[model samples]
Target: MKMWLPVVLVSLLLGGLPATHATAGTRSCNNNGIVVLHGMPLVTVDHKCVQILCLNGLPMPKLFENANSGCCEFKNTLYAPGQVFLDGCVKMTCEKSKWKPVGNTEFRCKRCEVFNDPHFMSFDRHRFDYHGECTYALTQEQFSRTPNFGIFTEFKKCYAVPSCLHRTIFKDNPKLLIGIGYLGLNAPKIYDILINGEKFTIPGDNYAHRLIVKEEDQDVLVWRQGSCIRILGSNGLTLQQCTNSIDIWAHPDLKNKVNGLCGSPDDNIDNDFTSRGKQVFDVEGFAPQEFAESWLTPPGCPAGRKKGSAKKNFGNDKMK
Candidate 1:
């Protein structure tokens, strides 16, 4: 019975029961109350940007310098380092856990106005008059850049006058087009507003992609402000149309980057007579008639019979 007892005990230990031995060559890590095996991916908890991973039999934690925790916050969204965004007309970028201005932070806007009898005021503040009946480029990015845009004005006879701004077109690159038309100079109200060839209503907060339309008294305003340019890829175009005039505002970033009737916007009025063919006429010898004819939209529109010299109020100061 004793011999049988010994054999039975050995048999039970070898086969009848599971072996009681420590696991070999196996590693794991304990994170709080959770168990993680070796070779597992990094794990994050409670939205903490810091991550932990199991290496060998121990847990290792690492902090990422450029992680979401270090990103810039704008309007409840996170922006990675070096990501650029627009705050109103100001350009900003994310860096070192903060939002910083990308270039010049100053908010500078240049104004160009076309008023009564269609007097022209360039962005550099050089004023002139062109009495031609044809479509002409008001302002354009002569050197193509991203989000290329331009404005065109159509002149027609109004109240027997040879030239009056009958319609204005704001073209955004290859897709978006906005037009504001007037019946006549004396017409008390605007005839209509067009978006991509379709009649559109004013005061539209949401229309034509990212454009915001609103009515300010007698003027119809179209603009893109704040972070709206994230989708439009532009600082934004501000167009204000009234009964007898049109005002176009350009962002400071566009300084020295545009041409056409608005002329070069380098803060130099002497070069305001830049022609469509890239020829700059001397302000002293400036021939307003020839300069106006060079900007005819179709290259060969009918010449205005009532030709006159532009006000030579700008002196003989050479372009600097």
Candidate 2:
């Protein structure tokens, strides 16, 4: 259930509503009655999505953009340039104060509260205790927040990390962990052949329930769904001899779902992915329930303290 959030986000980002393209030098914030904003999704005024005031969901307009000038945003066109907020807090302030960084990159500024919850502003019907949420110590060592868009890279680059790459290639944010591939003994020969733009060769032999690899990106170029995984014999991609479901593709498969306290990213998700790990996907990969209990636990302490292995351990001695 938690894994489905990333799927919802993908659909929103890719399926952003169509808006009029702006002309050179002049960006019509009020483009023919439609409000648009920079770095935000298009929210039609008077749309059912909003309920507070008759003003409707405020559209964050992209004020200016160019190869030279990246992009600038105006907050509802209300506060002018002179007006400022207390650093780290969004409330208005006459003096400059400390500024809080949001997420992994130095993209957007946030209030002390939004600093706690990136997904909190989605504010819709779903609201959680962002201030109380705690990130894994490992993540805190490597990144500021969930290495999300606007924060990392010039834009959102690491968003498409592979399953193996999670907690490995990136900042080891457990929230990004999505189990892929199961070690199946009798699990047939190849259940799914996940890939990006790059094509990989699978060995001809027994079957596999899932395909898992460690990489940094998964910008899918194309997929051959409704096809079966077959032995790469002299015939090349022979579908007739395909024996496994992972090999014999009847249904369309997507990508793994992201799980975390922050808002789900805007991207496509393949529901086939689950958080259950290999037990469900690869029967052979199953371990004793007792062993699985302490799977997420670390053997040592965090990076802050010198030799305080007994100092702090997440999920173990949090309250103490």
Candidate 3:
């Protein structure tokens, strides 16, 4: 069953009525006439300048007006800024805040849409929707909070992401160890890298320090060595080495290796991009649940450790 709270409570939160019952704001207008606030044309037998109060279920102006100046009675609906509601396919949103009700001013609400494309994944009420085709994360953070707008209706915030030029690959099972295409010098400045279920953030400023991918060079291998992952460049040059879930994407080619937590990166499958990697929009058919357990593991030991230890190992890392 649909339930609703009393409007008086809403008014309290809105700070609509005065705290005390003082007749200071009221004065005698028409002699033998009802008493009311000085300028307002409300007719009341009691000389109370107190603002008229009404609850949600009560009807309009007559609730607070006397028979004499009942024509002056007008009801208003209050709304706060950033609140969103839907009026069918078009959405309505309050652009500003209004605590107390005023007369005749129309409430202006902007209109919006729920879906920009049908091919995109379905919108999840609780979580953000990823628009792989446009690389936007549609969020419900901006939905309206106005009373009666809707508990379910949500306005969206389309967040732009960096380029998704790489593809995806998998080891024996695509669920647990998912692979991103090989990384190159021209990789996106910002993107998502998920290992298991953990995410790694690579910002624009540290792109040069965090990534080193040779264009068209398949000799270098990027793989998950058990709990630790590493990027093996030419001449056995270790571009990057860490044991935690690695968060970065690259092309589909190069090679992939999976080793144990204490195992070397060299022992694993060499899965390269057999063809062009799938784009974001094309992934709707592939369910996200197919991925195995996504755990939040700490990063593997530091890269370039001496004798495969978590010691400083990037002695020859050129800051390209």
Candidate 4:
């Protein structure tokens, strides 16, 4: 039998009238101005296929399953669980009580993260660490095709550590370039940003077709959510620069179509160690230091020592 909680709790919250003095033969319940005889069912006005039972001088609501029951409501329409519908380009499913996306909804992008000790998580969810301190391409379109874009990061010795992320650059092919530079160890909260080689202040204006730059508390956010960048397709991209970490995300259109230290997100972790020179390294082998070195920015920049190197002075010389 279908069971339900007593409606007395709900009635109390709605400021229900106090229970009338009960005699042996006059036991009944009044709900929404209707007198319900004991053990009789009353259908509520708001819900379908559910009934309220007057029992013991109180109203108890219960849900019953029928041909029209166990369905979800959306805009006054009922849909069976697991029913799929489309709202524009997005496909949604009614799951018993709520609506959920079916697949590849907006904001469903692949993520690549660079965090403490400069560890890396690729777009395909492969995790690795590369401690080389040099500017490197974090991710970019395959073969640097036109309408291409690239996210790069420069690692430097900071707080005496050999490799710490100190700068991030997002280049949208031929024209737009955004650079985010972190202040030195003593004053890490301050940031120096540059747009197309000119100094850019915080809370900057949104570039219509490119990206929006905003400062939130201590971190700076650069994103293209609704605005479509050709390389990222519709879902767009987002980059968050925190104190010592950088987080990046690219739309699903970039899957299997990108190459860098972030790897090609083809859903296969085996080839995630592909080097800048198009060489694939064995995932089970030793750390691919050469793969990391090949992505060094400027084509000929010197590589920084691994994590075990002697601590440096962390002065202006190390910031480059």
Q: Each candidate's TM vs. the true structure?
A: 0.53, 0.16, 0.15, 0.51
Q: What would the per-residue lDDT of candidate 4 be over residues 1-320, giving only the tens digit for each residue?
A: 11233444445422343344222344676655667667764333222334445666655555544423443433223446566643212345655444444454345666788876567778787766666667788887674523257788877666754577767777754456666663331222223456667664443223212233332111112322222111121224456566666667766666777778888767888888788678898766554777777666653345544422212122333110
Lowest lDDT 10-residue stretch of candidate 4: 215-224
Question: Which structure is stronger by TM-score: 2 or 4?
Answer: 4
Model 1 residue 253 CA deviation (Å) reads 1.1
The clash tally of candidate 4 reads 0
Q: Candidate 4: how large is its RMSD? A: 19.3
In the range 1-320, model 1's lDDT, one tens digit per residue, is: 00112222333333321223212244764444455567542243212233344556444444446554444433323456677755434456656544454453225767777876667788888766666667777777773322257777777677954456667777765566666663332322243456567765343233212243332111112322221111122434455566567766677677777777778767898888877767787765544666766665543355653433455433342221
Compared with the true structure, what per-residue lDDT tens digits does model 2 show for residues 112-131?
A: 11111111221111222111
Task: Estimate candidate 3's RMSD in Å.
Answer: 26.1
User: For each candidate, what is the lDDT?
Assistant: 0.53, 0.20, 0.22, 0.53
Assess candidate 3 and give its TM-score to the true structure: 0.15
The parts of candidate 3 lying over 4 Å away from their true place are 1-20, 23-109, 116-320
* Clash pairs, model 1 backbone: none
Best-to-worst ranking by lDDT: 4, 1, 3, 2
Candidate 3 residue-wise lDDT, 1-320, digit = tens: 00133434434422422223223233422222333333342221111111232323121122323222111111222223333422211122433221111122122311111222111112111111212221111111111111111101111122332112222222212233323332321234113344334554343321111122222112222333323243322221221222111222111121122111111122221211011111111222332311100110112112431111111122332321
Backbone atom clashes (below 3 Å) for every candidate:
0, 24, 18, 0
Q: Residue 235, candidate 2: how far off, in angstroms?
A: 55
